[model samples]
Target: MTRGYIEGLLSSFPKLMIEGQQHTTVETDAVRYVYQPLFEDMYAVLITTKNSNIVQDMDTLQLVANAIPEICQFGSQDDIVENALQLLSVFDEIVSLGHRENIDMAKLKAIIAMDSHEEKIQDIIEKNKEKEAKLELKRKAKMFEMQRKNAAKAGITGAFPSTGGIGSMGDAFGSKNSSNFAEPEQSTYNNEYSPKPTTSAPATRGMQLGRKTKGAEMLTSLNDQVVHVSTDEHISVVVNRDGGLENMEIKGDLSLIISEDDKNATSIRIACLQDDSIQYKTHPNIDKNQFNESGILTLKNQTRTFPLNQPVGVLKWRFVGQSEDSIPLSINCWPSATGDGSCEVNIEYELNSVHMTLQNVIISIPVESGAQPVVGDIDGSYDFNRSTNTLDWQISVIDRNHKTGSMDFVINTENLNSFFPVSVGFDSSTSYCQVQVLEAISENQSVEFSSSSKITPDQYYVI
Candidate 1:
């Protein structure tokens, strides 16, 4: 029953044309397909989430259209139109019979929306036809005398009367498609409408072919990765992928850990899969050529990383963005050979230790599966190494000793050299520190040592 309904739905949708490429598809359940009519002989498709089965069939058509926009090169425009009409017809049949029980108010709304969108598409297509007619008229006025000669060359089969104008052979075959010898010269810029702008802008030239577009809806393409985050206040994004990780697959729940010292001082640690990459692309509903600050950052949203073997990297736990009550973060990912690697980062901040003004600083830590540490208490001597300016807290630890686990340290950097001699602090100027976890597991459940860290430096350091 579901299959039949799907088939019916697909049978009703129109075939979308972009350039010469065509898409006649029903898409799938829980999916949205957009056909934008661009300039003459041009169109585009925006396919959003879909059920697995539908994705396979629809993706094939999408890949072809994306690779080459000239759909008519392989077949006639009539063939493309017929394909679309057949699909839409099937949809009409299904809706009429009511085979699917889930068809309710939402589905009906979508159908109405689809109808409205198609109407707009048809309007664009008509506009393009009118523009094509004007260009054809100009072509007809060019060589009035050569009409009979070209008519004779084209033969009289289906060749309507030329009316004694340039409308002889050129009208039958497109001016661009004119026989190599008889074709007239073309200028660098013809009046032909440049197809509708990509998801980056609005239609500046009124030419419309037959494609799906988005005015404000989410429009996108395959293989495009991005991160969308809304913290109930400010929205932030990071949209670049190059010498960086690309495949960003969110397996489970992830979050941001923030610590605040009163209302003024705040520290943040974003504990997520670090080395993921996403293709931040422009929203399909928008145009590519329009001047929009929105589009400028559309392609690059957020950057987060985590290394597989090392467990962490430079920016694993750093300040992403600040808020009144919380901090926001985002990341993108694409497929990579390194097993979707990322870097884990941790940031520690201690304030006013000299005066000890701020007491009871609240610390927040977001733990991941297979990565939580067993907290252990240490009983040993605390000694300050003035020679190396370091503080050493020695403790006795053993495997299966009922005391193997992780520990958190709160220390000040300024007084390090005063008691010991190292550079460590709780201020913004302090460099990042490493947190090491030592565990003892038997050969049956062996002990392993792993570590992760976060750091801060001038942006120039990367260069």
Candidate 2:
């Protein structure tokens, strides 16, 4: 009968503990079963002795609850203990109120076992909380170690755990320390020879180091090679490759240091009035139309020819392909010339700023005239000189209107590369200008004076 009663209660409370309300009176003939031998015998003794001390009996019941396996199916011994204690607590109140007919000793003991059942539950909760706390501490410790390693990699010295508290975990990763990681300081990596900034550009290092993009320098060099409005003919310069030539051609990058004063000057110009050849690539034998397919194929030969330098202006060359497209492949010829070693007839004159008058100052004369002078249209000059010379000289003016007698000459080691020396003096009485000429004489070449100043004192004579 006791086993039957226990089974019936177990069926109602599928879970170990039954948290519910039951009303009305009930009676049963109970049969007991012993899954735990000692606790089951203690419980049966309490039931047989109708006047058992309920608190002492409830304590024994709780011991039974604790002995039950944690993974036991729902409504096992522990749950039974909890629910029985609760029901007995209510039954004691009922018996005290004189409604004791439904009271049973086993049920009363089960109800009083609530304290022990709850104590066991509290122990389990506490254990899980302790484990979680330990895991959290481990996580925090690993994060701190990572931060220290990162700081060391960044070369920061004396870094220790912060008493002020940790910063953001995200910052401790690769982000905040990235800039300092394995990087030299700006002051250190920079060129030590770089000139300090001043009003003028730095003579040694004109541009800042590390400021140029990866491919910018190469692009800029190619851009500079593009021709834009050639004003004068090409000039001669040293044609040596910096690192010797190979494969009948030069490779590797080279730069020509041009003076700021001559940056605007034309790269090419006529060397003399005598007909000199504009160099070109020519092959006497090989023509493009009849390639190697023709029998007895003769390779082309190259020669230089003189072309008339009529257009007194500059021309630029933009490189395309250097070879013929079809099978008769021949390499293109490039001009290996520079203006660095060339010379120019740089003319300088001092004029009276106040007078604003025109004076025909003789710039050059006949040195011997095997080579005639070539002149472009005289670009107007600022500030004119008031001349006092009474002696007039004949000036050779080219008639550009007829398009004849016009001459252009380039300055070189062989030609008028040497500048004509000019001397200027003032006459106080007439406010006239007096001029003397300086001549360039080679050991073999002879020079002569052909023109003189045209300005006299009549114009600027103040009454």
Candidate 3:
């Protein structure tokens, strides 16, 4: 259709146009045009052949128009101009080879999110370089410690032997010279030992560490790494994962705690394996919440339970926010090769930002049916089990607001699968339920609270 043809029809419907009456179609001899006014001075016009089915054609046109907002988020010429390249791709996907094809919303989003693998690979390179520098420093420290230990072995009467299975395992676990968790009043600035903020949280722009965020639900600590609090009752929480908290026996006085009468517990997760719940035993007087569809134990409209003795609850149930939430503790593994035929695996793992402290933090890595990994530099103690083709790492304790540990292993590529998630386990105590209302609200009560969570494949990735 000619511009004059549409202009003539548009002139007659100028009143309707000004009133924003969308979905107006003007038919002409050669083609039909459906117009949707976008902004003050611009519009989207979808022209179709006269032979095309009007309803189907118009619906497809609407779908294409709807997806524009998903891309630009607002209706402005600036939005269109800024996303020119991406919109151009969207147009192609909506109409393949100048013919309308699939109009799948999810597919379009996935396409946009998957931006420039080369850029991501470059980022990984930059991060790995920083990690390698830290590894070198660790090597120098190890050498210094070994020398000090040798000297002490001669002069000191009861010093640990140098030939023990762990050359300096005691030094790694609990040493005054080493960096440990900071007290609430204590702080560190711009040092390797400083506790970094949550690296696994959702990525954001212009987020500086320890700065107060505008309109945040809760003000995070510029220093403390123990717990994160929000507006929901000043609730400070940490789920412990000490000593892997496995196959434990609890013989304490049983008391189930409750919170505000206006609120209820939405999640109850034990970080042990999901299958281990079969071993759980609770009292008949307990008013326990059952698991939701997503596996969180959803509790509502309940008060404190009567006290009993001897209670046991094994870790079970998938987390309610499993897809969105990150692991409080995690592992990162990268497989690479040396110039020679030998291959190496670089691994870094640490505690995430949360309220609880994890004691006896450990990691388990599986090897192929028959392969030995040679790893030195004792940041933590390691034990190999030939029967299971696995290596177990034991760190005595990982306290709140602490730095991470890294190490390298030379392994045979044939001894491993393409990739597998490293499993981590720990034990921890509870953050009690003690909240107070300002007004003539209910009085606060303190009850012991213990919880934990584990993520398998924490964040999924390929080798």
Number of the top-ranking candidate, with TM-score as the measure = 3
Which scores higher on lDDT, 1 or 3?
3
RMSD of 3: 29.5
Using lDDT as the measure, name the better of candidate 2 and candidate 3.
3
Q: Per-residue lDDT tens digits of candidate 3, residues 1-463?
A: 5799768755654443435232356666766666544444555567677788654454455446546776776667888899988888887877775477643443455456642222332233233334444564567557756766877868973554343434454454434234432112221111221223323423334556885432131111201111111211011112222212112111112122222223222223222223322233323322244422332322233443211111122121222222212345556666676766556877776665355466776666655434578986646788875433456677876756554777678876632332243545555443211111111112233223332222112111111
For model 3, the stretches where C-alpha displacement exceeds 4 angstroms are 1-319, 322-325, 414-419, 431-463
Q: Worst 10-residue stretch by lDDT in candidate 3? A: 228-237
lDDT of 1 at 413: 22
Cα error, candidate 1, residue 351 (Å): 37
Q: Residue-wise lDDT of candidate 1 within 333-357, one digit each (tens)?
A: 1121222232222222212112112
TM-score for all predictions?
0.18, 0.15, 0.29
Instruction: List residue ranges in candidate 1 displaced over 4 A.
Output: 1-107, 110-114, 122-126, 143-463
| Candidate 1 TM-score over all chains jointly | 0.18
- Arrange candidates by TM-score, descending: 3, 1, 2
